[model samples]
Target: MLESYSRCWTEIDYAAIAHNVEEIQKLVGDTKIMGIVKANAYGHGDVECAKALQKVGVDFFGVSSVDEALHLRQNGIHDSILILGYTPPEHFHYLIEENIIQSLVSYDYAQKLDAYAKEAGTKIRCHCKVDTGMCRTGVIYQVQEKNMDQILAEYRMEHLIVEGIFSHFPVSDDLGQESAAFTKKQIELFEEVCDNLRKEGINPGIRHIQNSYGILNYGDLKMDYCRPGLLYMGVTSDDAIPIASKPDFIPILSWYANVSLVKWIQKGQSVSYGRHFIATKPTKVATVSVGYADGLHRLVSNCGLEVLIHGQKCPIIGNVCMDQCMVDVTQVDDVKEGDVVVLVGRQGDHRVTIDEISRKSHSINNETLSDIAGRVPRLRRREK
Candidate 1:
């Protein structure tokens, strides 16, 4: 059995991450890969995962903010990093000082960043973001003439070097006819904007429009780079429709906790805080050393959530508490305190996946993974 000094911990398979990178490489023949390490590699430990990715030849990284990018740079990552989201104008100097590329979200934002960079007597590298259809960020692509003028103004900024242009796909993962058509239009619009820039004697240094889903469903699109987040993490959302040619990616994260106490409960006795669960019969209950505070979602309590104990599925008996939760272990033979409990990993013939947890919690895989608190230590594992 695995033992941890902490209440719970996550085991990261570096080998599996490397294998997933290789699989992504196969799809994107010569194009560059921007390993999205934002949100601490989706709560898989950014620095460690970034180091593992660097070992596999991923030279470019995408982060959500300047802090995340700086975190990588400070941790000995010398690779090129682009902030895919907003960065305060006050931190524009940091981007230039750190040689980190900032995403030009809007023309106004660009002007503000340029002003800061100009005052600093330096130029900040940037990737122009076009709102093709996501309508979230970036300069709107619907107004082509106005959008072209705005992007041209950004490229013309002396203190801002627009080194690349990219956009997002809102529904590229959905292969249904309507959704697919909409995605196609988004790609076309992004390309058209890039082409327009080129026509104005401006070099849109690196043109990339593919995200994780875009890479999977439209891998044939010629682009200079592809940013993959969830795909690189080796798991997709439970609702994500899989393509026939989807590469085989190994899941890289496993969560485990130790059984803290074991006790038998009489019939009609409830457990935990709320009297939500009453023992129909004499049942054995084991309190796990993990709960909501440990990244175990309280929503999954009594919602068909189970943990593997003695290689058997034990049902969560009551409402999950902040620091602990109880699970019925009557069916498990010889289950006792100090036993290893598989919260989100394989145990014998059974495996509880992130997708399973997401489904039970009525959330997405990204939330389920990133919701894991920082208190849970992420230990790296290289499977042989």
Candidate 2:
């Protein structure tokens, strides 16, 4: 697993991913767990992580786009794949070819898809998304609402099949009581919609609304399927996971870089491209090969952000460049070029977690993980 062949790379633990899936399965009990593998599996390498979950019998997989679903199919992932977001009409054929489930967010999109499927002489599986609160996608759960059949009007029986109905909870993870009321209302609206659809003789096959935070906080609610996004990646950014969760989630990705060059700057010497970090004293600075392009936010420069070198915390000294950054390592003796530098994850007893990185960058784990550029190679650790 120690392939230091690149200036910057990330190591993904397959065993930890498998462990997360098993634990999530145990948490939700009989409810189907749809592993959300969107955004490259939250930047853990989508196909690799999905394969690991698939090996352990993951109930389903959710992706954000048709291209992502196609990537999984091309990699031989034949499991049930659902597009969590909308699929433009142009890419509708790809969905038909793979038999992947599409999400119907609007009546017009659904109608067009139904007609296209009818002409193709193929049936399409899909889930109807209801907008409980988050106004991004899905049908609004309120007035002007047409029943399921009316929304899906003229859908040839053989052309389109509504396999599930779902809604997204915008504030499900909020700890405050106010957010609680919002979540509850969202759930009630979704249920009411489902009931109205059923009364109208429309089948809502598998019902799911809970995301990672929702599952952690409200898994007991009714639902045929639960989407496990971040939690399945062993990243616990939610409050509920800490309060009463049994599973031990270990971060599966560790970012690393090599000290490509080492130089000693005189006292008062500025580091890197800016004078933002002026050395207070004569110090030895190590040029670690990682930068904003590799996902290290430039905002972290001079933020007292530290990376791990020789299991010691070394402060980032200046502006994070496009391909490199500098850190003061004068306190440590015998430091040299090509030493292993850890940007995230553990280094001996000292560790840098996604939480720490996110705090420093002023962003969430989702952005922190996915911001990792594609240029850096991902090293998958299978056995260990």
Candidate 3:
């Protein structure tokens, strides 16, 4: 019997991740795959996923913040980890000390980091972000070209190493008119900058731009490296960008819990708080040890949500409480306590995908995964 320390736990499949990487490798061919382990590997568990990715020969690991990079480094992850977002000026010291690379988005940021590195008597590595179309970060490609050139030259003098130059696409996952047109323009602007720099003998170490969606859609326009975040975590983009051709992804996350209580309810009786679900007839209700506190969305409570219990699809009854939720298991014969109930992923012939839950909750799978509380331990499993 499968058991867990807590009734609610998130199971991660390292073997499935490896398989996903292998499948992506077949499609991308030589284009490098930068493992996107940001947001705790998109809530699948960061350090664990990083180690698994390392074993499979991933090119690089990209994180959202400096703290995330530090966690990986502290856990003996010596591979190159790029902080995709901003790092505070006060903590720039760790960047040099830990050999972590940062994305230099603005001239002021670059200047501050250069001075910080010099004061520490160490060189800092950074990638200049080109704001081709995405206005979120980086220098605007058109108006800031001259400014970028001067900054690059000044960086060399200040002993700041420009390890790479990259940009982000706003709508690389969408095939819609505006998204495609804008993405194409962004790609053009990004490439032109690289080409212009090289023409003037300015060689930015490594070039990369494509994200998970880009890898799926515009893969043929491969650059020096690509970032695979959601794909590596075993789910597609929320945008539902149609794929041209690629390997099928294996879902790497499975949320499970044990049945804590089971009892028969008489007709006209209600289950859980607020009397949300009233039984019209005799019903067997199995209470699961998972609730909103355990990353189960509150919206799912009192909603028509089903979980796999004893290889049977059981509908959730009443409102989901802080510690548990009740499910109708009357149809599931011989139902008892301690049965494994799957909230996400498959069990027997019945399956409840995270995508399904996301749709039901009117949210994305990534956001729902993030809601999974820290109390829910993520157990890594590799099926032999």
Show how many residue pairs clash in every candidate, following the order shown.
0, 0, 0
Task: Point to the candidate with the largest TM-score.
Answer: 1
Instruction: State which candidate, 1 or 2, has the greater lDDT.
Output: 1
Show the colliding residue pairs in model 3: none
> In candidate 3, what are the lDDT values of residues 1-384, reduced to their tens digit?
246657899888877888898877766778888898998888888888888888888858999999999999999899998999999998988898899999886877888888887888888888888788778878777544435564455346475888888888778878788888888887888788788777778786678888877887777776878888888887885635476566688889889998998999999999888998899999999999999988888788767889998788988989999999999999998877878899987888888988767777889877887778889988876576
Instruction: List model 1 lDDT by residue over 90-182, tens digit each.
Output: 677788789999999899999999888888888889999989888888989864434778988989999989999999998988888999989
Please provide, for model 2 over 285-377, each residue's C-alpha lDDT reduced to its tens digit, 9 standing for 90 to 100: 899999999888898888988889999999998899999999889987777888899888887788887777788877878888989999998
Candidate 3 regions with alpha-carbon error over 4 angstroms: 142-157, 239-241
Q: Is candidate 1 or candidate 2 better by TM-score?
A: 1
Q: Whole-model lDDT for model 2 versus the true structure?
A: 0.82
lDDT of 2 at 167: 81
Residue 354 deviation, candidate 2, in Å? Answer: 1.5
Query: By lDDT, is 2 or 3 better?
Result: 3
